[model samples]
Target chain A: MPVRVAVDAMGGDHAPGVVVEGALEAVAEAGDRLAVLLVGREAEIRAEVENRGGAEDDRLRVVDAPEVIGMGEAATEALKRKPDSSIHRGIGAVKAGRADAFASAGNTGAVMAAALFGLGRLPGVLRPALPGYLPTPTGTCVLLDVGANVEVRPEHLVQFARMGAVFGEFFLDREDPTVGLVNVGEEPGKGTDTVKEVYEALRALGDRGAIHFVGNVEGRDILRHGADVCVCDGFVGNVVLKLAESVSTILPDLVRAEIGRQGLGADHARTVGGVLRGMLAPFDYQAHGGVPMLGIDGTVVIGHGGSTARAIRQMVLSAARLVEQNLTSRIARALADDDAPPHP
Target chain B: MPVRVAVDAMGGDHAPGVVVEGALEAVAEAGDRLAVLLVGREAEIRAEVENRGGAEDDRLRVVDAPEVIGMGEAATEALKRKPDSSIHRGIGAVKAGRADAFASAGNTGAVMAAALFGLGRLPGVLRPALPGYLPTPTGTCVLLDVGANVEVRPEHLVQFARMGAVFGEFFLDREDPTVGLVNVGEEPGKGTDTVKEVYEALRALGDRGAIHFVGNVEGRDILRHGADVCVCDGFVGNVVLKLAESVSTILPDLVRAEIGRQGLGADHARTVGGVLRGMLAPFDYQAHGGVPMLGIDGTVVIGHGGSTARAIRQMVLSAARLVEQNLTSRIARALADDDAPPHP
Candidate 1:
């Protein structure tokens, strides 16, 4: 059977327009390997699809989800208020096995809540986490608990480490992925009491070859790809994710201002800007698709709210890939295997 | 009397050489307004001073401190291990009223420990916090406690807010600077219990005109200069500081690689690199001098370990300014005046 991705056509800033376009692009590219179920208001999505020269293939179809969740609505409350919301319905499609995976750029909390309620957590999973991919000069780094559990214990972090490793190995297609605990200092004894315990646990896990643990990595290490997977409490991880994203826009603006100051002429400035933009391509959040909500029973990817058509397409394809790889079950097995005494 | 800044000549990565050179530069620029007491091994300091073509003014003097603390030494233990170390003696000079302020580019923990042991905390101050000046496109943003308190209660954060405000207003020359609490999200109740409590307390204080509290700011707001002062528990703040510092180097390297890929000629690449560097000048930690360890009884400035002579000079001058402005007492008064029950 083809991997079917349920795209939230009413989610994100541009909503139906970009979402429909992106889904079409994904279906066209994936051929027989992928199918898409655009979940949102049927009329709007269909019009958007027709406007984009229409999807000529049968792999693409619309699943009507009338209720649309606003970005500002509180998650749990919104999920209750709008059961047929695109975010809820999209994930529900996955829950019903009508679609292999779900993807949305809507209210993150709502999507997470709906996923937790509908698909439920994988067996033995303590908490589901949001992981964002950070682009480094060497390669991509996976940072987990981006905004899932603001205050997490050592156990939650350890689970994130295992899940992140699985994501890196399967999704990113990497060898034995290295995990690093984000700390204020690089030393083993550094950080809060919770982090200290986490260090010991992750280190113990590393020794047994459950996951490749590289010990403590400071914030500077995140962008440098100091480790394949960087784990931290959701508070710090969320802060770091947003901070890293700002660099792409902020740095380019700084350069452009300087170019103007130097009177570098229009031609030279354009060339310089083009080169900088090309370099920052990897840093673009929209192009990379959705970040995964790991530990869920089924595939769920959350893209940037400001996602372009390109980002939406990437999110659909990425969701399809995660379903094919059976990331959810892999995570469940990893957690269960780690349940044995780490010291033994 | 001239504001006397006791410089730790035997501290920092460069040590006596750059320290001596920076002191000379500061003294020269300040003329009779500032005096620098270089504390280190007498012979090494004198040679460095001579190597810099000697100091012609009596404003510069060398204070012999035979013991030198290594960068890797434990903070509290190192202070006891090296009684006559430059870091200890420099702060000792301030404690003994021989100098108005103390500045070091050595081990941060050692400097903080030394300052705490020697000068002690200011009246009404629960913990001494370190604040770093971040270069924003608009103006500098003060972030604290960079590495002081890893875990803090709501009360400690309130104290940080007051202290950071004082630093912003007095040292940064801002008019009633706005303070923001860094969190995962921008909403009032969007973080851990500690942060939520902090938000309510700060809001109350803002209403009472204790300090200009601008509500919660996300990490992306940091570089955007969302607030004049950004406050967080040191764990997150330290990570943010390190992450922000990495941008100058990482972004440049990315651009250079892209330039190579685009096959831009050496001359064009050089021009682009130069422009990028010029724009990134404010991001340079060395140029901005030392970050202040606030809530201490006396002025204490902590410079980067990798500080160059220019950075050292800036640190010395910054120290002198802090002394001249009586920043220590100002912080004390800010905290003391805030003793009234916030709600009442």
Candidate 2:
């Protein structure tokens, strides 16, 4: 059976054009293995799908959702007032069992609100986390609670570690992916009381051979590929994620300036520029498609606000993969199976 | 009339050799305007000075302190155990009115301990902060509380903004440097209770024109030049500093890989590689020399653990600049003049 992913066609900067186009691409690429439920205003979505020559495709369906959620509106307030909004309708499809997953690139808080209110939390899941993935030379490093929960307790961090491990094992295809608690220093007593307590919990799990805990990892290790999952409070994780993205954007410009300063002729510099562009192509967030809202009852992948057609396609594909891989069930199992101590 | 900077000769990975050699370079560069007090074991300091050809310079002085603090030693524990340690002796010079400032590349916690316990906090300065500077394309961004105060209150954040402004005006040479409380989001009520309170306090300061407060800035803004100074808790600031440094280090390799993927001939790729190396040269931590510990009564610059002679020289230069500009008095004035709300 094709995994049906409900996408908010009205979401993100690109809107119906890129979102509808991306769904078409994902459907075409997956052939019969994937179906997309485009949740948004029926008129724009229908026009976009028709323009893209996919109006007749049985795999693509448009769910009429006339109301919209503005990017700047308060998420919880918007959720209550705009029940017919794309975010609400899309996630609602997942709750109603009409779609296996929901994906959006709209206001992050709105998406999180939709997931929390619409689908509710999974069994034993304290808080849902936004797991942001950073691709390195060796492998990918997953940072959890990127923005889902700004204020976190020790147990929440431990839960994030477990969820990250399950996600890593499934996505990276690694056996027993290592978990590391992000801290200022690698020492045991480095961070605040919350972090220290989390460290002790994770460390105890490692001792019991329940998890392959790599102890404390500093911020630089986000790119070091030292561990499969790096867990921290959403505030820290969100900051690191944004700073890293900025670094990727700034690095290329710095490289270009250096190339210009090399005293090379314009033509030669242009040639080198093409090659360097190809090198940095991987760092593009579009390549990863979207970040997953992990630990929720249903799968939800959040793309960048400025998501391209390909980026939208990637998000749809990610959602399908998660649904097919039984991500939610596996995460639930992983959490339930764990015998680690709770908050001290 | 010379500004004397007491440097921990025993600190840093490349110990007495780089430290002594750096002091020699600073002496040569500063002429008679600056003097360096090398604090370490007398024998090693003397040999290094002789090797660096600065044995004849009267501007350079050797202060004997045989006790050494290992990089791995617990800061408070080591401070009590090794009273004769270089950190203690170096700061002792400042306390005893023998040196105008101090610089070290040793264990960060140990240096903070020496400063707090030996010299104590300046009047009205609740806590001293380790302010790390990130060099952006436009200018530099100062981040405070990188490690000095892991546990920070709202007042501490408000105070850091004042100190950062003074440091920026003197060091970065910016007129009325802008300040931003580092937050997960740009919205007013986005983060924890503490962050919210800090935001309100900083916003009020901006309104009063007491400080160039830019409200809340996200992680990506650290290198955006949107604000000259970014304030956060020690934990977040430390993560950001290390992560940004890692990105700077990792960006080049990623770029090279990107260039290699273009399938260019070995010679052309080599040429491109050389250009990139030059481009990324500035991102090197060694280029920045050292970070100044702000909000203290005395000037203290903290360098990286793996400090080279060039890095050490930069640290000394930074310390000299701070002293010559009378950074302490300026910070004290900035805080005393502020009309911001106290901690709730």
What's the TM-score of every candidate structure? Answer: 0.96, 0.96
Q: What is the lDDT of residue B175 in candidate 1?
A: 82
Give the whole-model CA lDDT for all candidates, comma-separated. 0.87, 0.85
Over 4 Å off in model 2, which ranges?
A341-344, B56-58, B338-344
Q: Which lDDT tens digits does candidate 2 get at residues B15-56?
A: 989888887888889988898899999998898888766674
Candidate 2 overall Cα lDDT vs. reference?
Answer: 0.85
True contacts kept of 2: 0.80
Local error of candidate 1 at residue A94 (angstroms): 2.0
- The residue ranges of model 1 lying beyond 4 angstroms of the native Cα positions read A53-58, A338-344, B53-58, B338-344
Which candidate gets the maximum DockQ versus the true structure? 1
